[model samples]
Target chain A: MIELQNVAMSYGGGDLFSEISLKLAPGSFHFLTGPSGAGKTTLLKLCYAELMPSAGHVSFMGRDVRTMGRDDIAALRGRIGVVHQDCQFLDHLSVAENVALPLTVARRPLDARELMELLGWVGLKAQADALPPQLSGGERQRAALARAVIMSPDVLLADEPTGNLDWDMSLRLLTLLVELNRMGKTVLIATHDLNLIRAAKQQVSARVLRIANRRLQLAGADL
Target chain B: MRAVLALIRADGRGVDRVVPPTGHTAWLTVLSAAAMAFLAVFALALALATGRLADRWSDALARSATIRISAPVDQMPTQTRAVLEVLATTPGIADYRALDEDEMRALLDPWFGPDLPVETLPLPQLIALTETAEGVDGEGLRLRLAAEAPGAVLDDHTRWRRPLVSAAERLRFLGLISLVLIGGATAGMITLAAQAALAANGQVIRVLRLVGARDSYIARAFVRRFTLRGLSGAALGTVLGMIAVALLPEADAAGGFLTGLGFEGAGWLWPMMIPPMAAAVAFAATRAAALRMLRGIR
Candidate 1:
């Protein structure tokens, strides 16, 4: 579980967000909604220790991010899968290889059967040999999802997971996140897409946190 | 050591997937390594050859002295006998013999023609003294020679020979310095290439880091790649250098000093170390560069 209390982030001469407190409990699903340039990505980066809170404390599993060493951060990252908005993949590597990258980075043995099964779960088994550029946007997102879950991470933090997907593809991706949560993995997704959030709520109950005016607030019954 | 072992062994499990190969940087590393190793070969050869030359000069000049007794033809025989008697009592003198007229002409044959009229020329009588390992005191021998044979001058070859020995020693020093500089340049070039590769593959590195890859894991990929390139290129360069050296006219007593500027006998084994050394330099350079770049990111 990741916790941030009274956290604030800033860049250059302006504050991105301030005095934010949030707790991502075990197996809890949350949707982080914010308009463009509202520090959703910055908040997610703080969860993974990619960016430190300028003020207050951000802790992962009861340890402060400020005190964690580089190696410790990497080890912590292995337990938390992050799906970027862009679905960054090594462009030169095949889709299958990219999905199996976490296992490679963690220096674990690659079971080809398990990798194929994971790819099959993401519906990308057929495009396993294709490069990232060769895959459709939906396929790339799925591949990124497959890569994120390859390690069976305890927590999954995704930024704009359905940003470029069609309605059906977004639903399918939401179903994957729902499936992961059902399998005891905590999930937090950052996006401005209210429809995707509404779609996800029916499958799995998710609290929505909205970032506005440099603060995070639980949304009212406006939905 | 354990960490190094881990880094090396991790490659076997295929960590290379993270940072995809950049062709231009790979070629740059190999080419720089080869060029550096080639220059290193020449530097090493120069050092070894000059070392041998210095040794030859030192050993040949250290124990010997020449006695020149110049006198009128009537007094030449008596002066030569007096110089010989004085040399016989010299403590470090192993052997002494007056050069015959024909021997002196042979020494002068390079300057004057071989058919020069040696008997009619008023050349001085030259006595060659081979000294013991302990070596004669030139000062003591010179004083004795002056008393016994006034026309005799003792030449220990130190005046002219000192400069030759110093030149050889300086050349050897310079060659070694050149070798060090070449190695340093190779490391610099490899570091730049590694940095460029890391920069070009920034997204790849970012993805890898996001997936929980440690710095060492990322660096090992580049280190193994650059190290292999360096080794292969340096191996080729070393072989080429050896061939070039081998083809140089073989040094012999007749071929003189110019021919001696290469490896002789067991000395050929020295150049074989260059490839491995270049590989080590590449490994260190790339690892440092990769680690530095990784630290800068995230």
Candidate 2:
């Protein structure tokens, strides 16, 4: 439900990317591939209204992101879950508490049973009470995924969701994204991992979009 | 107003999960609030005390004047009688009487003691004049006294009394100004403390924001916390200040201005307002700092 047309991003008096166009439709999965510093993260930021485009328009759902107020942006964000590469968590909070944060911020009631089930789905049920700093990299990635989907968002955006994980961990995390898409959630992931992309294709059909020379293009069966 | 009500209702619900209570800044906020409120109690006491003093001085001096007959010993009685006759015809004067020897001696007791030989000295005769609520015209009274008794001088006490009243009024103004400064300082300190908390918990705030939390939600967590701390600390300070005021030496005729600096009667209720006022200041300061910091994010 996020659309960007002719979007350009600039920083330090120069263009980081320009004339990029993409649309994330319902229940469709897409992978964004780019090398280091090619503005993959910045593109993800634009989709979530974290960064406004230097040119062109970005719309969240049906409304323009530029015209939305602060409260309206917050409400829109609740419908779109995001997973950062760093897997940011309130370290003072336990793993289970961190997973339930989206509902907490939205002022919704916490369902202990649902939280446990989500933790179980992410293979983090055993580490529910552990702190973020205490969790391993793969565990943190899974926990972040659990947090992202806890709200049952209509769209999920993950930036390098498996960047710090091993192949097995990465594939496990990829399967989680596939399961979410199968459940009718639109998913867009930004990464440069070709092997993960090939692994993902074997289980689910996902369009691959590559960012090269400051432009977004649909890559054909390259991996 | 509805937004304020929502913030209030949303205060402690799930705030601890997002912005946990930071210890050092919490202690700083409480201590600063307590100290500022303690100082404010004295400021309030000074204001109330000076207010009462001004009213008392104005009322006691407003409706009265004195006429001093300074004739020679042989002609003093004659001039005194003439002055009395002039006062008798004065329209606004409700009553007039010459002070007897014992009354004059008692008036000078504190300064001259009880051993002064009044009959040996060429002392002046003092006549006390009481006026109606409207009061007598000083110029009219002076002209009448000059015609009837050449040596009589009408002293309305305005020269000395005006300065005293003005000084008390200025003191009251100073006390009020001090209260304002104290409130401003309290707000400044709480704002700094809130900023420090925001900076220290930058990651926490970013995580909360990423999870679809509104700016008001994040701000309410801090605002509610600091407001409660200010209330508790100021409440303690107010009680201690009231106890300290109550223990001051009681006012007496001899104690003069210093003894009257403490609260009297209904004035005791004034210091009780400091706690809630401190809480309000904390609420405003923390909310402003929180919102400003949140705008800088994302």
Candidate 3:
């Protein structure tokens, strides 16, 4: 339920992409692929209103994201779960508290049992009391994902969710996204791992959008 | 512990999760607050003392005037009697008393140490006059005194009273200025503390920003922290200062004037407000710093 129509993005006063467009439908799974410096992260930033388009509109649900107020944008973000590549966490807080941050910032109370179950979904239940610095990269990523989806957001956007993990951990993380997709959440993941995409295809009939020549294309047939 | 509880419950407006990176200045907070409170104690005393001085000066001056009759030793008693008769018929002069030998000796007791032989000495005849608030015509009374008792002179006590009143008023003003400076200094230190905290918490701020936390939410944390510290420190200082002020001597007749340079009854409550006022200053200063830093970030 996120759409980018003729969107152009610039970062630090340099154009990264222009006039590119894609729509993310409900319950759809899409893999965003691109070479290094191809603006994949920039595209996801546009989808979530973290970065506004320099020349065109990025729409979230039915409203134009470019024109929305900050409060409106924050409210919209509560419905879109984002797992950053860096997996930003308050190091002073425990993993469970970190995972529950989105809800806390939204002024919602935490459901302890439900949060533990979500933490367990990505296999991080035992590490709930551990701080971000105390966790491994894979564990941090899983915790980030659990944090992202804590509010039961309609859309899940992950940037390099499996980047720092081994093959087994990558598959385990993918299964969590796949499970979310199966449960009616739209998922768009930015990754360079083709093997992971191939693996994902075996489990879910997902589409692939490849960024090249500063444009987004359906790369499923080529794959 | 009490401060922590107030912060956690924070009136439901929400605690801002932002604090300065460099951390808190617990000692500085306490020190500045204590210092200001101590000085404020003096200021409160000065203001109260000035108020008392103003009342005493006005009271002693308002209804009183003096008459001094000087003449050759042979004519002294006759001139004094004539001056007294003239004063009794004066319109606004409500009452008059002629100071006798023993009364005049008592007046000179402080300076001459009760050693002067007053009865054998040739001293000026002193008449203390009480006037109605409406006041009689001093010029007409002086002319009458000159005609009836040529040596008699009327003194309104104006010349010396102005200087005394002015000196006390100046001390009161200086005390007030000290209080204002103390408050301003407290605010400045708190501002610097807030800025330092902002710099130290840069990473925490970056993380919060990336997570889409608003500037208001982050600033609230710092504002709450600094404000509580300021209030606590100021309160401690105020209590200590008040204790010190209470130990000061009272202004009885035996105490003279220096002992009167402190708070009277009911003037004790004025210094109690400094702590909260200091807290408000801290809250405003930190909130502004946090918001400015937040805006500078993406």
Candidate 4:
């Protein structure tokens, strides 16, 4: 679980957000909706300890992010999976290799059958040997999702995971995320897609939080 | 010691495959290490050769003196006898002998042609003297020679030997300094190459970090690759350097200094250490660069 109390972030004398308090409990699903420049990605970065708040404290599993060493942060990251908007993959590596990178970095043995099964579940079994540059947008997103869950992290943070996919692909990726949450993994997604939110709300109870006017406000009976 | 073992064992967990392959920096590291190692071999050879030359000059000239008797042709025999008597009475004089006509001819054979008439030309009579472990007092010997043989002069070879030995020692020092500079330059070049590789692979680093890779895991990949490259390149350079030194013309009496510039006896084993040394330098330089670069990210 991640907790931020009275947090504020700034860049070069310009304020991105201020006095924000949020808590992500265990096995809860949440959606963060904001405009393009409303600091949605910045908040996600803070949750993952990629960036520190200019003021106030952010803690992950009871440990303050500001006091953690580089190694400690790395260890914490292993317990939290993040899927970036760009689907950041090593362009030279094959799809299967990219999907299994989390396990590789953790120095764990890679079971070929499990990896193949995971790839088949993501509909990338045929393209396992293909490089990232050769994959379509939907394929890259699904590969990123598969990579994020390969470690079975307790929390998952995704940033615009379906920004480049079509309706069916977005719904498919959303179903995978929903399935992961149903398996007791906490998920927080940052997006501006209302239709996707409506579609997601039909299947699960997801609390919607929107960032407006440099403040985070819970929506009141709104889409 | 642990760092060395880590470098050797490496992360057999396929950690090195995370970073994409870089072409330019690989070639740069290998070629720089090879070139520096080649120069280091020659510097090593020069240092050893100069050391030997210094020792040889010091040992050969320290315990010997020469008496040159320049007198009128008629007084030569009397002066030679007087000098011999004085040397026989000296406490530190181990042995003394006046050179014969054939020995004198052999001494001057290199400067003058073999056909020169040595017995007829009124050259000075030369007497070679060997001293005991405690050498003779030059001033006392000169005073005695002047009283008994006025034309006799004692030369203990100090003036000639000191300058030659000093010059050889200085040359040896310079050779050692050259080796140090070469190693420093090699480290600088390898550091630059490692930094460039790290900079070019920023995306690889970011992706690895996001997936929970520690700094040590990331650094090991680069360190192993660069260290191996340095080892292979230096090995090639050292072998080629040894071959080039062995193929030089053999040292001969006519070719005095330059011909003797090479390893001798057990000295051949010295150049074999260059490859491993280069590998160590590469390992240190690349590890430092990788860690420093990783600190700046995230």
Candidate 5:
């Protein structure tokens, strides 16, 4: 679980967001909606300890982010998975290798059959040997998703994971995320896609939080 | 010691496979190490040779002096006898012998040629003196000789020997300083190469960190690669240097100092240490660069 109390982030004397408090409990699903440059990605970065808040405290699993050392932060990252909007893969590696990178870095043994099954589930079994640059946009997104969930982390944070995909690919990726949430993994997705949020609400009880006027408000029954 | 063991243990762990292969920095590190190691071998050889030369000259000249009697042709015999009697009475004089005509001819043969007219040239009479462990006091011996044989001059070879010994010692010190400078240059070049590699692989580092890789783990990848490269390159350079030194013309009667600039006896084992030393330098340089670069990332 991640908790942020009265957190604020600024850049070069310009405030992006201020006085925000949010808590992500276990096995809960949430969608964050905001306009472009509304500090959505920045908030996700704060949650993963990639950036320290300018003024307040952010804690992961009951420990303050500022109090943890570099090694401790790395260990905490193992329990959380993140999917960036760009699907940042090492372009030289094959799709399957990129997907198994989390386990590789952790020094955990990888079962070839299990990796193959995971790739097949993401419909990337045929392109396992292909590099990231050779894959299509949708394929890259699915590959990033597979990589994110490979370690079976307790919490998943994604930033516009389906931004480049078509409707079918988006729904497919959403279903995979929904399946992961159903398996008791907490998921928080940042996006501005109203239709995707509407579609997600039909399958699960997802709370919507929108950023407007430099404040995070629980979205009413508008959507 | 632990660092060395870690390097060996992490050899085939596939830790280095995370970072993409770099082109220019790889060649740069290897070539710089090889070049510096080659120079270091020569420096090591020079230091050892100078040390040995200094010791040999010091030992040969320390306990010996020469007495030259320059006088009238007829009085030469009397002056030589007087110098001999004086040396025999000196307490620290172990032995003294008046050099005959043939022995004096041999001494001057290299400079004056073989068939010089030694009897007609009115050359000075020479006497060789060897001292005991507690050598003669030169001032006391000189005063005694001047009183007894005014033509006899005592030359303890101090003026000639001191400068030669000092020059040799200074040369040895210069060689050692050269070795130190070469080591420092090697470390600097490897650090630059490592920084370049880290800069070029920023994206790879970010991805690795995003997936929970510690800075130590990331640093190990670069350290192992650079260390192995340095070891291999230095080993090649050392072997080539040894071969080059061995192929030089051997020391002869004509080739005095230049030909004698090489390893002798157990000295050959010294250059074998260069490869390991280069590896250690590369390991330290690359590890420092990697850790500093990582700190700025997240």
Candidate 6:
């Protein structure tokens, strides 16, 4: 679980936003919605310990993230997969290699059959050998999602994962996230698409947090 | 990102793999190391040879003093006998010898040729003297000879011999310094090469980091690649260099000229160390360069 208590992040004091408080309880699902440069990615980065809170404390897995050693942070990050909106990948690697990277970095032996099954879930088995550069935006998004969940992580954080995908592709990715939540993994997604959030509500009971007035608030029943 | 995961999970405890994948070839590094190592062999040989030359020059010149009695041609034998008698009673003289007819002729063979009749020529009588640990004062011996045998002149061979030994020693030192410079240059080049390779693989590094790969693991991939290249290349250079040295014509005893260029006896083992030393240099240089490059990103 990730907890941010009285957290304030800023660029030159009043440039963007600051003074936020939130807690991502275990096994819960939430969506973070904000306008461009509203600190959505910055918040996600803070949760993952990639960025410090600037002021106030951010705790990951019960340890203050700022005090954690680099190696400790890396180990903690291994258990929580992240999907970037850009679908970052080593283009020289095949789709399968890219998807299996988390397990690889963790140095865990991978079962090829299980990996193939996961690839099948995302409908990317046929493109397993294809490089990231050759994949379409939809395929890339799905591939990115598959990569994020490959670790069977206790928590998942995706920053606009479906930003580049079409509506159908977006739904496909959303369905995957819902399935993961049903399997009991906490998921926090940062996205600005209200329709996607409205659609997600129909599939799973999830909370939504919005960044406004330099603080986070529950955007209940707000499209 | 997936690659980082795979790397981390491939080995338990998140240990960074120091060895690169087999297909990550580095022929250029191997070639460079080999070429440099080969050149080092010659430089090493030069150092050793000059070292030996210095020792020989010192030993051959040490403790040797010559007595030249320039009496009238007819009185030369008498003056030589008198000088030898006086040298026998001298306190500091450890050993003394009067050269035989053939021995004296042989000494002048280089200048006078084989057929010169040494017993017939009225050359001044030469007496060889070796002094004790505390060498005899040449001037004191000269004054004694001047009083008893006024025509006797002592040549200690000090002036030319000291300069010769010093020059040889300086040459040996120069060779050693060249080897050090060569090693330094090799390390410098490999560092630059590693930096270039890392820069070229920036995207790869970014992807690996995204997948949770630690900085050490990413740097390992590069360090291992360059280390192997440097080792192999240096080996080739060393072997080829030794062969080239071996092919050189054997040294002749023609007074420290062309023949002084190659290794002598057990000195051959010196050049063999060049490859491993080169590899060590490459290892250190690449490791340093990779770590610096990694930290720059952080």
| Runs of candidate 2 exceeding 4 Å displacement | B1-13
Go through the candidates in order and give each one's DockQ: 0.84, 0.76, 0.33, 0.82, 0.79, 0.39
RMSD, every candidate, angstroms? 1.7, 1.9, 3.5, 1.6, 1.5, 4.8
Model 4 clash tally, residue pairs: 0
Q: Give model 1's docking category.
A: high
Candidate 1 local lDDT, B126-235, one digit each (tens): 99989998888888888988888899999989899999999999999999999999999988998898889888888888888899999988888888888778888899
Query: In terms of DockQ, which candidate is strongest?
Result: 1
Q: After superposition, how far is residue B132 of candidate 1 from its true place, in Å?
A: 1.1
Identify the superior model by lDDT, candidate 2 or candidate 6: 2
Q: After superposing candidate 5, which stretches have Cα over 4 Å from the reference?
A: none
Candidate 6 structure quality by residue, lDDT tens digits, B1-298:
2332343234322232322233333665676677778778888888888888889878766878898877788787778778988898788889998887888888999898999988788787788888888778778788889888878889988889989899988988998999998999899888877877777777676666666777777776776567667877888888888888888776775554446788877888878778667767877888788778766542
Interface RMSD of 3: 2.8
List ranges where model 6 is wrong by over 4 Å: A10-14, B1-28, B90-95, B99-123, B130-143
Better-scoring candidate (DockQ), 1 or 5:
1
Q: Is candidate 1 or candidate 2 better by TM-score?
A: 1
Give candidate 6's error at residue B107 in angstroms.
5.2
**lDDT, candidate 5, B1-298, per-residue tens:** 4685569566545677778998988987888888898899999999999999899889889999999999998898899999999998999989899998899889889999999878778888889999999989999999999999999999999999999999999999999999999889999999999999999999999999988889988988888888888888898889888988888778774568978889999999999999989998899999999999999977
* TM-score of candidate 2 against the unseen true structure: 0.96
Candidates ranked by DockQ: 1, 4, 5, 2, 6, 3
lDDT of 2 by residue, B1-298 (tens): 3443444566485785578778799888888888888889989889988988888887788878899999988999999999999999888999899999888888888899999877787789999998899889889989989999999999988888888889889999999999999999999999999899888889898888888999988988888888878888888888888888888777785577977888988888889889888888888899999999999876
iRMS, all models: 0.9, 1.0, 2.8, 0.8, 0.8, 3.8
For DockQ, candidate 3 versus 5, the one ahead is 5
Kindly report the docking quality category of candidate 4: high
How many residue pairs clash in each candidate at the backbone level? 0, 0, 8, 0, 0, 34
Chain A TM-score of candidate 6 vs. true chain A: 0.97
Which residue pairs collide in model 1, if any? none
lDDT of 4 by residue, B1-298 (tens): 3464467676543866888788889887888888888888899999999999999999989999999999999999999999999999999988899999999999999999798899789999999999999889989999999999999999999999999999999999999999999888988898898998999999899889988999998998898888888888888888888888888777785477877888999999999889888888888999999999999877
TM-score of predicted chain A against the true chain A, for each candidate:
0.98, 0.98, 0.97, 0.98, 0.98, 0.97
Alpha carbon RMSD to native, model 6: 4.8
